[model samples]
Target: MQALTSSFVSRSLVPTTPRRHRVRPLSVAPMTVCIDQSRKEKVVVIMGSTGTGKSRLSVDLATRFSAEIINSDKMQFYKGLEITTNQITIPEKCGVPHHLLGELPVDGPELTASEFRSLASGSISDMTSRGKLPIIAGGSNSYIHALLVEHFDPETNPFSKPLIPIELRYDLKYMS
Candidate 1:
């Protein structure tokens, strides 16, 4: 086997056709691709177990994409427990806007999954309306799951039919 030299590379890349003549390498200028997303809604959700750099990555992405972060960690919902919950500090947030961080009182009861979903969804909607990317740095998998899926019962098999029939009538439509 013979090793390729720069001589071989330059010769191989040269125009081989008789009339084509040798043209120098194409000088491609840096291209800027701008997509018109005014009518589109976008959100980025980052999720992982603890200490996986989700927050850092979210901040970096938010900075680059002109985005804001939404806190999806259940524990981070309550104020005054940032250290305990491993929530990102303001400095760590890197001046990238963050939403739903420590909004609830520490002594207040934990928000139900439905409540979290509502608040997070509203925040994301508001950010998108304002032309900012919504970066969901999800600390709690359950909360992320609840926000994204229509029904996410852990006991339920996602691929299988629900044990409880959907058509079974109940006067519980008001909950919606």
Candidate 2:
């Protein structure tokens, strides 16, 4: 019985005959669109450690590229934490559009990576849709990673295997 089973398995693994190959003629022509580099908006994320002039560089680049600035520092999002957070100055913002900066109250509870990711992603999409470059400036490495890196899905918790908070979806929308 064992021998019979082995022989059957071996026979099953082999092809009965030589395989025939067929080549299909290609008919569809490739289409290309000429894009204007100037019109193509890009997202530039400036990230580093504290006091590294991340904001300054972002502002300068935004000014040169006609881009909008999105604040990525976790602390800089709160109002009245300017000095402590080293938030961008009004002069630096310089009439350039800024998003998610000083929007939350300082006393407000800590915002999670999920929350920040959502807000930043939204700002990026809005700016890009309007044909403006999105410049993400901040010193928070984790916040930057949340934006640029692919991590676990926000919807399903790996450990819990349960549905993630609905807010996570809201936050992820901005990520794209």
Candidate 3:
């Protein structure tokens, strides 16, 4: 029995043991990875109070980056109020594509933050998907807040469901 055990141990330590397969080092360079053309664009949200030149700054930045502009201001959505709302000028919007600017009527129904968030998200998605940067420019505090912050706790506030719809609560909306 002792000799049998010794023979088994000797067999386990034999030099003819088969080796496991090893992974070959990757030869491809990291920089060679192709970037998706759809991801070339980004969304830049510019927010400020009235008369803070948000529109102008957005236009300038969009021009420099060859991006499209999306209006986030509530009043700027109405047409025929460009001077009153200080909306983007026609010349400023010439080369760059502008969305949701002067698209609604002055007497049109008021829009909730939830509605704005949906529209904004869709516009941003469309622009970014097409490899174009989407710049959100506006003076509305709530509009900026909705775009930049997350949600309020449902447990903390029982009325949270009614206070603001689920679609309205975004991660960035709670950041600020």
Which model scores highest in lDDT? 1
Per-prediction count of colliding residue pairs? 0, 3, 11
| Per-residue alpha-carbon lDDT of candidate 1 for residues 92-146, written as tens digits (9 for 90 to 100) | 8878888888889988887977788788778877886788877778657667656
> lDDT (CA) for every model shown?
0.62, 0.60, 0.59
- Residues 1-176, candidate 2, lDDT per residue (tens digit)? 34522542344323455557432211111111112334433455555666545565556556656688888788888999988877778987767888989999878798877788778777766776777777777766567555654453446434455544322111221210
Write down the TM-score of every candidate.
0.64, 0.61, 0.61
Candidate 3 lDDT over residue span 107-133, tens digit each: 889776767867877887787667776
Model 1: clashing residue pairs?
none
In model 2, the Cα lDDT at residue 82 comes to 87
**Model 3 RMSD, rounded to 1 decimal:** 23.5
Q: Which stretches of candidate 2 lie over 4 Å from their true place?
A: 1-41, 151-176
Off by over 4 Å in 1: 1-40, 151-176
